[model samples]
Target: MGDLNAKVGREYDGFQGTIGKFGIGVRNDNRRRLLELCGASGLSITNTYFNHKLEHKTTWVSPNGLVQNLIDYVIVNQKWKKSILDTRTFRGCRRVPSDHKLVISKIRIKIQANQEKRRTIKFDVDNLRNERVKQQYEVKVGGKFAALIGMENMDMDSEESWAILSSDTKDVATEVLGYKRINSKPWFSDEAKVLSEEQQRLRVQVDDKQDLEKKQQLKRRRNRKLRELSDRMKHDQNMFWKERATKVAVAMEIGESRAMFAAVRFLRNASQEKVWRGVHGMLDEDGNLVTDEMEKRNLFARYFERLLNVDTTRYWDKKKKKSIADLNEALEVQEEDISAKR
Candidate 1:
């Protein structure tokens, strides 16, 4: 068997005409582009199916409705430029055992080698007359007088006349007639051309300037927001410290919370010589501020140090200083007395 060599093209399913064609693949857009480039319009249809394996004989079938549909597509769309004359179907083309037939379409697409075109030329001037000349030029009275054509009779339609008419190109009557009067038109002035370019250039410059200004505004907004946040952080820190100090002072007055915080702050607020420490309670019969006597028995229990100024431990030492000094001096005197007595 010989290969037909025709490239596999656009495929369709559900119809029976193209099923047995070899090399048919569902994936290929080249066939679609080729059909489009062929000036194809309307619908050129086909239908096909094949077995997954080669053991089964190939089958092709073209039903009457399918053929009519293709024809209808061609007719409705007025494409193809050729007619589909007839279609043939082979019941399992020779040795095939498939139930469907092999279908072939006889199309009238072939054309004569020499296509036709209009080939006539004549001299007539009505298609080339002006609006005013329409009623007059229709008379065509020029036999021999010739009238020295353009002195005062002819229309003022050259570059010199057009330039003298107006500097603005907008004022010119080119569009109403047809194409530009390039041959008889005044040259564009270098100054006007330069001005036009500058106008566009200025537009670009303005856009860039606006963009730059927007960026600067954005940067300023970001910086302002950041500064506001920073200020808020500082204010929050101050508020935290202030509230903590106030809570400690209130606790000391009512014994509602620990006195350690108030003691520390009292030390901080005190003058260098004044310190506050320990728990401050009402004076006993002896007229001294008292505290829990055991845990507070350290030097801290002896004196009232300024809360804001006192580092807890240091203030505690100052509070108990007299007791500590007396103890040391008493021990020293005892030792000396013992030696003398000896």
Candidate 2:
């Protein structure tokens, strides 16, 4: 839940399934948009569905205390509408000092655990670049193959023979090159974390203080701590990126294409993972939500199969023929020029 600032008032006329009659304030353009989005996505505004007091419903207030609106909301899928027990705003929370009150929702869900665990085996293949490791691996693998060849007289099927070969190769590789080690480092330093905690403490103190002067003083210190924390985070982030860039540059300079590409791919996959985390599921042709991984893969495969096999023969008319002829003519001329230069 967040400060959406969309005043979805108590009008449930056409959006009966998306909103409820208990919402506060007058409806605005943003409210209409939010309603339409929720309706289309099969989501319900949990904050509006539950009945609560005015103080518990309103999430934001003006500085002069003249205007109060229920702008923040907790939205959930209509399929899980019964799972959300309650939704309301907590105005008495002094831990965070903000004009917007804390909007929270209590949800009950049962998660099933997978019984089978899939483990991927990764070898230190990068070490194979070393001459000593390469020679050792080759010798071990060659000896295993020789032993397998000596077992040719046995009554073994093709599958068993193939399995034996594969197992022996893996055993040799494991003995020669070890497993790859993964090392993860945090981005922020201890100083930044300390400053963040101090800022939070000051905020709570400012909210609890009775005297205006003391509250103002606490607020100033909190703001200073916030600035310091922000600067420290920026410094840490820059240093992290700087180190990554240095590794990429060194790999490129040394002609290590594998290492350079691996670094680039890691950065790309990290960004893709961050973007994919927000995507919950996809809708099928019947407008039903598909959450299963295998089903989603099948849906994508079917969609692309139909899209890529479209009948485009009608578009291959005189203009396309002329374009192809021109391209071939240019290629012939280039081939002739190359021959002349040679």
Instruction: Give the candidate number with the greatest lDDT.
Output: 2
Model 1 CA deviation exceeding 4 Å by range:
1-42, 46-78, 81-83, 110-342
Clashes of each: 24, 0
Report the C-alpha displacement of residue 146, candidate 2, in angstroms: 35
Q: Per-residue lDDT tens digits of candidate 1, residues 57-108?
A: 2233244424211111111123542365533344445575433445555566
For each candidate in turn, the TM-score is: 0.18, 0.34
Q: What are the lDDT scores of the predictions, listed in order? A: 0.42, 0.83
- Which segments of candidate 2 are over 4 A away from where they belong? 114-342
For this target, which candidate reaches the highest TM-score against the unseen true structure? 2
